[model samples]
Target: MVADREGGARRKPARAVAVYVAGGAVLLTGCASMPDNGDLRGVESTPRQDTQVRVFAMPPREDAQPSEIVQGFLEALTSDDPQYATAKQYLTGQAAKTWRPELSTMVLADGPATEADPAGVREDSVNFSFTLTGAKVAVVDAEQSYAPAQGSYSRQVRLVRDRKSGQWRINGLPQGVVMGKSDFQRNYTSVNKYYFASNSAVGTASQTAAVADPVYVRRRVDPMTQMVRSLLNGPTSWLGPVVRSSFPSGTALRKGAGPLTPDDQNKLTVPLNGKATQVGRAKCNEMAAQLLFTLQGLTPAVDEVEVQAGGEQLCELDEDGAAAVAARGSAKHPEFLYFIDGEHRLVRIPPGGSRSTNADAVPGELGGGERALRSAAVSRDEHTGAGVALDGKTLYVGSLVSGSSLGEPVVRSAGKTEDERLTTPSWDARGDLWVADRDPEHPRLLVLREGKGEPMEVQVPGLDGQIRSVRVAADGVRIALVVENDDKQSLLVGRIERTTKDVPGGKPGPGSGVSVFELRPAAPALEEVTTMSWAGDGRLVVVGREEGGVQQMKYVQVDGSTPEGPAPDALTGVKEIAAAEDGRLPLVAYSEDGIVRLPDGAQWQTVVKDGSAPVYPG
Candidate 1:
């Protein structure tokens, strides 16, 4: 899903997982076991004695050994240490196996200081809600900072724990957050190519923090008493606050304060014997088509397509061919349309066109727009507008006019006043222009093809509300627009009549292609779908917050089936998601927080923090 390039989405990747528990150990100790009732068919029919096994909660051992179970897990994950051998002293059963070979490794680590550090604790409880027998420990965060040449580094750690077995054992860990490949391509790549320093990657935590925290970089951290007090007293203070809040109030409490949710990062070694195939140029072309086609399919169709439009054999499909594309609405095809290739570099046309041709030339069609879009002179109103596909040819953009007069050449404003509120400009591949006026009350999405002066307006019944979001398939036949009604929870999906020009029923026959589906229960009430985009094959990616503080990102497949329920991995690990522009793999997830990326996951350079939510074009 793509975020607005101008203002980055604001969110703090969740710091740590929250674990809650109720009923103290004393309450559990006196509990009794009961047999099933005869009337209940699901329950066991046998009647047993009302008896109980009382297990009392034990106090923390004063002489408990300092087991480095949590720290060992973090070290093994971060610096390629063989500390997994030492982890068994603490972990047991399936947890031992899960911790054995780190599923994926993280590049850095952050946690509480070790025993050697000045502020370090000798030992502590690992679980956040431990009783006398069972303990649960979790890693909160792990971060590392390296010196030049990737030599030595300092690491920080945070952990949480619950009382258990009169002891603490570390349980879960934290995940890293990063950008998706498509997002990197569209927003950061080449955009900041000049600002990056040699030997340093841009958009990384260290680099971005270097720029973001100017004061911290310029000045030394003075060891002042007030600073110490703030660390111990202030709201943002990590150490002091955690100790006071997490540690048990009684003598059972040990040195450890909170559950340390260390980053559980590990990497696996795999052998790749085959030579990698070279499809760089072909791949780039597919990516461009996917991105542009989706936009064109949305509103009024533009006249021409642009995106390195110089390569001669670039793929092309006429208007009729585009409408034939259909999605069965299955899990694979959650939406009606989508892009095959989602991420690729877009090199704007140079003032002088290139003289190259054939196989020797670049794959993208860079120079075919009817009129060149001026980079410096493009309209500036802060509202970032993108080109939309209509009828497989023309591109449509809402035009900006200084005046509201309904001139013959200029599309008239839909507003009652003479104010220049709206105008639709249609352009062809060669940059040829056609202006069409839209109905003020019921605005139409115009589909313009070359030589087709009269544009097509696809019908959207029951669309009497403000448009909250819009997504157009890579092909022009399908369009999805989210409209917010007075109830705010309303979300509906509709198919457009690409074959006919009908309000309800018109032309040779009202196109059966368009049908609006109810998207209310699937989506939350009053929550907006902020980032909406289409993947190749018509998968719908919708990211937004729900009413119950649930931040959701879901996909609707165009194959005509409901998607599977989201698993733990999909919910917590998804950093960024992009559609492959080359169509090799329609979907690509960026960084998976703490879980190491899959061996086959797409390659991407690390991104520094610039306060923007990751962008995924496809």
Candidate 2:
């Protein structure tokens, strides 16, 4: 068998290749290299994405030259060698011990261009150097999360001769391995880690909201086992403060357990240490639900997961059981699409969007003509909703049932002008309400508890711009804001950190406070982001414009990575856009032509000839 990556068992790569045994020929893997992030120019695009072929990296020859060793080492970095044992053969004793393939990954627009240093011809000649250069694309951090990066890439590898064998070996290299985007795509596969919302303070399984944290892992290696360890390790740093792992602290896989694999019924039993033996049935079910969600997309489909501790079965969760215990973001289906119709009243359309029926006003005063509304957001449960008055000065909340009257105004904006008032409201899965007051002098983001309590101003520490629109994610741990600054509008995603107040002394308080922090760009490359909505877990469909470009719509990950699917078809005069966390639902938008929806295998069709502000339940 071929030597795997790190320690001889990492058996996958970041990209793809092809080797035909019948023809006995070697060919380079052809993958697109055009930079979508506008990092640089001159990268040529390839024809197509060929088949997936496993590459076997060979050990260094007895008398390898310094140039040969440099090339081989770079190649080995792209292989799925278990533990990267084969790659370490080319490194000196000191370098081998210090090297860590799992530390991080640097990805470029194309395969790095390697060139030997001109100063290699010294008379003493104890060392040689090779410079690697390429256009930066993105980076997979030590946690395996991907983020878009920019600028030129360059690194140097210095080689030295072994004292005893006189063989060439690499003594110095960068902290993490580097590869082209194609290789990264071939070698690694993206997977989601599941965690519960910290906003609820460790509630029961039925009440808890599970959030997804996306990360990358090797495809050919023991990915299931690797993913289990990653899930057990907890959420990534960016999402750590807002989410909690169901797994108990210090809980880990049994020490002598072999690689985890699914049985004939697609049930994978995970053996945890004694730390998990004490959790009651509710907690154990939540833990099993997390495992089932995280490993469902991996190979050999895991339909069931069982948690075992100290040689005894703790709990078992199948698809239906998991759904009942911990509801996932994708399981949410939008029942109706809401928008402001020609009469300026809140109205609803059947969610399928392909129906030919006319729009109907929702129950309650907010949907009636007497109280004109401009924008609105329905709660996750669909039993309640919040709407902004036509003048944008008052925000109202009430029930969705028949004959239900709109309650008193929950929030009032002092902005004198229409443009300087409250933005649309949003609801999180936790049932909390969110909105932004654009009263230029006292601009602030506000949240109402359960859409009925006093409006609390959310502190955004690093937000230097005014929030024009707000959309809290279904998980409730993240919120997206369209922030306007210096005449440009950018889409930013922030963490919703909730902490209980500290008592006068050193004790914890029962009261909780919430704040938004880590406001990073979700669409950094766009010059102006007009509107956006959470398309799914860790994904967004944004309407924005690139520098010196026309308005366009594209999907982006919360971490600022490029999206996986094709871009949406172009629509003109898109003033606002909305999407459901359930990706299968058609995308709804309010363009110049009024309200429209995109159905499966169909172009944008008119939902209403005179409507604006289309939205699905959060």
Candidate 3:
């Protein structure tokens, strides 16, 4: 299976064997009649019973007033119940029926403050508004599209006394739920749902491409089930047109909305509706691959998955098999790191010291004398290389094999001077070369198919800034861009849509290959970004400084959320950063001291004394 670039939709690299525990402990009991012998005299044993407990918040009190009810409802939104049953109790009958918490979510600065004026209050009704004055951090809209929140938000709620029970209840309120930043942190966790590339051809020799759709799920809720159900529901609005799912239309959980349980063997049995029964074995296996990849993030990760339709077994896949079907196309570690060495030649450093240092210039004209490369990018397959000349006016592509000469310039910068010429080059998983000419007059973003075709201009709508750098995600559908406007650099993520027209009996015609993209603001948490690269699983490792601060290295989710895990090591003086889709590879960067890398749990190590423009195969 082909791995999708954006979702890091590749089979996970195989892991080392793990030891097993039975019921969380070892059992060593024997019959007393024979066990009392001297051989067991010194043995000590203890018998213990397993204990389990679950805690849940109590529902709103019956005597609570309108303000108190509103407060409780907002607090309940942070609970672990995915259905928000407790939160609904604070609403009036009609309000509860109309409220759609999933329609959108407002991530507020803090808990809301209720304003109930005496003049606005009647004997049976109270009119008040929840004044939410804090900055909105982010928003999840009705279409499940998550983006950085802008400006402020406020909501008003009116309470009416129930005629039958005399209880104060929320009668009028907003359509979505609102939670403080702290509550959102505690209640929500991000997970990626896997889907096949829209053009993936199943059952053929063609590779399968998988894309990842990241979304937030309720913490402590059954994330496994939520993720699977969300996957079956399909990709969100922005990604819907670029990806495909193996689950058939109308496919749903057979057992209704409930947590999917795994048996003692760690096998999750998913019972689907009848729609899944019609799929063939190969297709069913592909569906299983999606489930396994989505649920792999759960605690006590699922080792196998069993799919059933109408209580009949349809397919089963083990961890290894599922990984094989969704393999990200290559091993997690990169084959080598390529950079411009002191001798002005394209040199390589094999990851983990697998190859000799400063391996001879990638076996071609690029490795020969006077090439004078300024920047370079190696394709994921390591079969091709793209680079920019020292003058930055010409772009070259060449083979990485021994004795192969560099190809003539496929793209030439229109800039009148070298300083305003082309920026660094990047390669996508599809072997497309992307670069931008910095000449303000022309200022164009271009893509060269397979690094050798005619350069095609891609329209980036609403880009009021000059392009600084461009990196395409492995999925080949999204691009991470660093653009500068008014001397301030910003990081942005955009969707790449390829438009083509079918020919009578051939591939897409020349005039049909137009590239268009919609740019969206990303990494709003950072004020200025210098360099960025696509980290595995749709995340980015960025080098930038916060407002009025020094530069630091941090990881940001594609949706603009600051992830909850530990931040990566902070490295200073970084000029460029490159990462492989398989995260096992260390992060390679060009620093003041030279080419440096940060391996997992280790400090930065210098690979070469003088090198620049370090890059890993995409």
Candidate 4:
């Protein structure tokens, strides 16, 4: 317990961790940080659990003891003080000038523990020292990228008595800030930085698909300005190989620009430096589109974005113009959720609707029930459909239009039985089809460019297990796979690298060999993953079971972290599940209850009495 400014006792929250002072009983409890402004609002309130209460940092008391000064400085680091000005007051002149808290954040498992240095305890000593220690859980870099880390953390902090004032101040410490896990959560919010897929264009098409790259930024800081700067800096390292930035090589916001905010008409004007002034009109528009899509998630949403350089407007883009350039995220909304009905035929229904009978049979051969189907996929435009035979021996490509005919099997599996054959087919944003052949004799991942030509075997380096299922993201760069080995299945997200290297056997392959490598575990805790689908820009809806546990459905991010939202309601006997990239759409699944849908804020509703595989257009 600590005394309040009014001489009352302040109780700590249940989960609060304590930072001990070096020579006294003073304890600093963890708290959520906010921006120091009257206009601050609850966008995504931190886990501090005091949403209605604001805690202001108390400055150092007059002639304070060294222990109190150390305790106050640590508490101020977790407060909502703007630029941490109050915290700086605890540091000496040279120490305040050298501290760079924005460079990085060191997240600990609990509040740091402080111990007095034996050498600084003498009465004649003018300088006192202490050791701050904790167990590090992760680190957030200057680029705002969060990566898991593990190790012991120890730093020496030194304080000296001011000669003129006879007051103690922190004179030596590390550059970055340190806090507990809960404090870190309250201080940052996740935001997606939009980028264009490097391979979205096919044939002569010019438009590209937008990919979402999520990052964490300090919510109370200058978020609008920080976000624009991150976008200009480009994508994270894991996603950098497959995506490209529309901004010129060295483009950046003009130096010393004020905080970025939309005008009364909901227009955001981005003034770039001279490096971006020479771009053509078409390229400039693409840059503006990226900005609009990236900023659509924040509060006070802007309706239009203008790009300016060298004091002149280069281009402008609204929602409509952004959609025409890069199709994805809020710019595009899916029409329906698809599934294989009781008759093992392809069917469709309005996403988030209750109708069932009127949703069967899409069109042409796929809807005609000419051949028994085990799984199916529809292209983004809902113009093409790919179906895998019930026996899993062949994959057929057909048009989703009336009076259209199904062509010969696009690809066939040589597996001896249904248990080892082609997996569900998937379509990419660039109009390509992907499938995996699980034949024990020759397992391979295959891709069909433009849904035609010879089947190309995709190279997957460093894979030690058999591929059971595959789902391609809307971005056309990241692919999710459920690989099984030694009776255990793992959910892995890998980068799609289109390379010039030859096939695995040193033989020339068609359409420039593409490899899926650098795979990272998306659900490292789950013992087995039954099925999954891309649910958002950087999130996936997964169904799996842990060791000695019942099956569960949850959303996992591409970077192996749990998201902020609640998990979908639990369901039993779920064999296959599907979710649209648009979060507004309902989640469809094929469970023991047959085809079912989970509408927003409602329990599961039956869509039909029988169905197996459910999916949304890629």
Candidate 5:
């Protein structure tokens, strides 16, 4: 899918309608002018406004039976309540106190089926089990990490009658709630909480890089509180190594602090415990920034955030300040598309060009190198470039600016022939470069840290196919891979894991090794995916053929759902495609006509005539 960006209004071409005429042509004869009816009166109509307020779902009745209570409790889990108060009514006092609804969530494709086993019931208690058989789109864990899930889920619940009230209440059950796809859609909304990049220099003028952590919260349930709480929980395991949260180790919301609500002026006040009171002013500002960026997605955007500790305001930040920080960390893409010309000279096309134009060669030795270049990638900081030589055996890294010369080949293919050579290079937000050597004799995916040292092999378990392409997310946690096996192409998303250890001087250094884990199939409905790019957090733009045998471009959620939006026009004979982490940048692709770009609300425009590979900084 194309990134969402602002553009000029699209002018649709006027269409002509075909009118059918009977044998002799209905409009063959001309008629005289008719007089106006001055006495006719026109009636005025007013639109009816809807004034009915929606009633919230209620808790189970006091006298509800055990079976009815279980059913009601499951249904109540889908309600838009900040605390699931209604759902707790069906649980025993002790059980309710110990239950953690946020521990995990099971998202099933269809409603679950329950069956009661009276034979297992005791004198005052009954037992029941629910059988859910359907596709599991995804699962969210206690850390609010979303992972693609599949297969069936089953669990049991036990209930006993309350001695005084004589109402059935749950005594035992699982920690998290289970809901069907429809209820999940109605009650849960996917949102991203921002965290600063761990390697970002503090107090520096450089833009602070923000990583997006996507999670689902109850719809209409105090999203401001939900987002802040999730942010405090810290980044997920996959992201923890790459991003850092502002909240201190022991910091937490003040006791008795209920759901947070904004005032009429769009100002929100957050109360923290004593752990936050010891933090300095700059740290307090960082904490407020986390809240401001997370709350920007609310229906009525929050304008300002005030953080307090010990009943005293510690720091406050407005939307403008928070926006500046976010913008500063954002990736600044280059103003041109660079590629190898016919003479193997690195050339570039200026941004927003209507057609291909001759521009100066890329600065430095790369532009004048003797080795023919096949593909290349620019770094997110736009300070370096990685290129694959035309022979497909050598990988070169060099400065993007004018004065510096290209370095020696950093990686070489181990394949016996040209077919098993290096693929296109890709960069991650952490400044790591990734590429796959498709040598059949020694197939492996390698990562080069800042283009230094020997490329390390990344373990990809259960991958029996030939690696075709690799694209890493800007967050440096997830990777998109296109693999071909048995003449079929599969698009998979995997989580990257890195282990760090303390070095001699107590500095943290790379641990044993890096590996990719929990590989899951995405865009499963597509038959043959040829290319893909990370369009946004937890979202991808894929080019593939559907079951009907038609090639198309569409957006697919990481959970295997196709997002609702207009698909970009299909490009025939497209060689490659690239997108920036920021959704506001346009999409560029290397097609038969040259380097073509799809600007917001605009059709494809050729930016360079002879370019083969077009890319933006990761």
Candidate 6:
């Protein structure tokens, strides 16, 4: 820290250690030199008449003596008056003019020095160390205002010098000045004074000589940052319940704006291109439903609320909450868990089953049926608990759990898990199943392949928040997912391409690798589209109301390469769509006074004329 002279401000230069630890001992020893002695009166000086004479002309004899002329120069300049009268006798012209004024306030203390090749004559040189006290001016040009007044003072100074003249003189010594001028100068001025006073108190108050250590500095971390970092660190059993209560169904990317309600059924409409025509009517089976919810994996709770119509309670929902919740079935008491009644509800039923007023109502979990999913397997019996993914030949059930830092998913073969724990599931192109269990402690992505008992796990690096969406690209070269970034609305992409496991303190896990892509498509506009489906070709189809105000269908090709902006019309204007195979167009279904098909004249028969909504690929 240095102080300014004019402004009476102090400036602190952020000092960092550049010394290499490898050869520290040797380097320190080599740099050591004797302190500058103030005895300049006895030293030899540069010859007055021989000043212009070249040394080459004189034959060298023994070693030349230290210059008293140089020594006198130091003593004279360091004096309050600079001994200007005597200095004028040795220096003339420019040299005399520069030091005369500066020397008045320039104060010098003892400095270190070391003579090298003292016995040698040619180009003999000595290194010296010096300490400066009082105030020094520093020039700064930082973005902010400069600090520290010029006239302020400090006692700390450390610098070195290489002197060829045996006599010590400010003119002959290598010198460097530390000062402040601009933004840095202004800020540093206050900072220096503040910290200097701070360090002084600490030095005087504490028993230990160390002024400020990590113990004191560590207190500066903001409380919010620390809390966020903790959750980011891993799953905590103590926090599990709290996290669950806040996010009952975890966090889910829903299709609509309203809270997921019992009547809300997110359907997948497949658009059959080519020559598909509007069919009149055909017998239809009830549609299957899929629900996904996410919480930070902290807390879980169930509460009750009065069911109201225009702010009037038609009836009090069972103690659990709502009486007829879609996922929970017809329960005597329903808590409306996961907002299955309030919002984010996806429910569908077979054609004939819709006749019952409460066919898809929430079921009672009080009879030891539904329980909290807290194990690594994430098993839940209630409809509000977990989800199951079904491909052509197999079904994979999954649920998010919070007992451990590591999320390890359990997979049961199609007919195996009548009473087994479920896990997070996905399907690959070859009809193979993939499961991922998130571990908060270890923070990893666990992948389980079908028929293979032992699963593969890979460590995912610094995930700042709960994982949102995970998808494997068509090329199998990347695993894409949305994770919360610093800003809540935006997401950051984390990619891991290494084929080898790079787990710290352990072997690397298996993975195509992880990489985060920055793009997020706008959610399906539910009013315009009732359902959304991702085609094998990477296209997305939304089924619902299209342009013209009539129920219609449309699709958009995502291909993972779409630039981010307003959602393309082709993607959001669909009523329903389905993907059959690559190169084969997905079938589109909609109802406008009657089931209608775009592109006209292919499959004419319709499933149901007055059906509430059509379910594709159920």
Find the candidate with the highest lDDT and give its number. 2
lDDT string for model 5 (449-538, tens) is 766677888998877688889998766667889888887777888877776475795344666567887667778767688778888766
Candidates ranked, most accurate by TM-score first: 2, 3, 4, 5, 1, 6
Best by TM-score: 2
TM-score of 4: 0.83
> Model 4 off-target regions past 4 Å?
1-70, 89-98, 113-137, 149-175, 202-206, 402-408, 414-417, 500-511, 546-549
Candidates arranged by lDDT, highest first: 2, 4, 3, 5, 1, 6
> Of 1 and 6, which scores higher on TM-score?
1
lDDT of 5 at 572: 83
User: TM-scores of the models, in the given order?
Assistant: 0.28, 0.88, 0.86, 0.83, 0.75, 0.23
**Tens digits of per-residue lDDT for model 2, 1-618:** 111232122222323333333232223332232111111211122222233444545577666667667656767777667688878998999999998888898888776665676655343466877777777888999999888789999888888886667788999998888877767776777888899887462112336778888898887677899899899989999999878887889999999875899999999999999989999999999999999988985654799999999999999999998888767667778788899888988889888846674889998876877678899999888888788999999999988887888868999999989889999899987678999999999998998877886787788998988899899988888899999999899999999987767578633356666799988888988979888999988789999999999999999888887755588899999999999888889998989888888987899988878899888986
lDDT for model 1 comes to 0.26
Q: lDDT for model 6, please.
A: 0.25
- Alpha-carbon local distance difference test for all models: 0.26, 0.80, 0.71, 0.78, 0.68, 0.25
Q: Which residue pairs collide, candidate 3?
A: 2-208, 4-210, 5-474, 5-475, 6-475, 7-212, 10-328, 11-326, 11-327, 11-328
lDDT tens readout by residue for model 3, 141-160: 76555678877675566667
Compared with the true structure, model 3 gives a TM-score of 0.86
Model 2, global lDDT: 0.80
Residue-level lDDT tens digits of model 4 in 234-321:
9988889888998988999998775998999999999999999999999998999889888886554789999999999999999899
The stretch of ten residues in a row with the least summed lDDT in candidate 6 is 209-218
Clashes of 5: 4
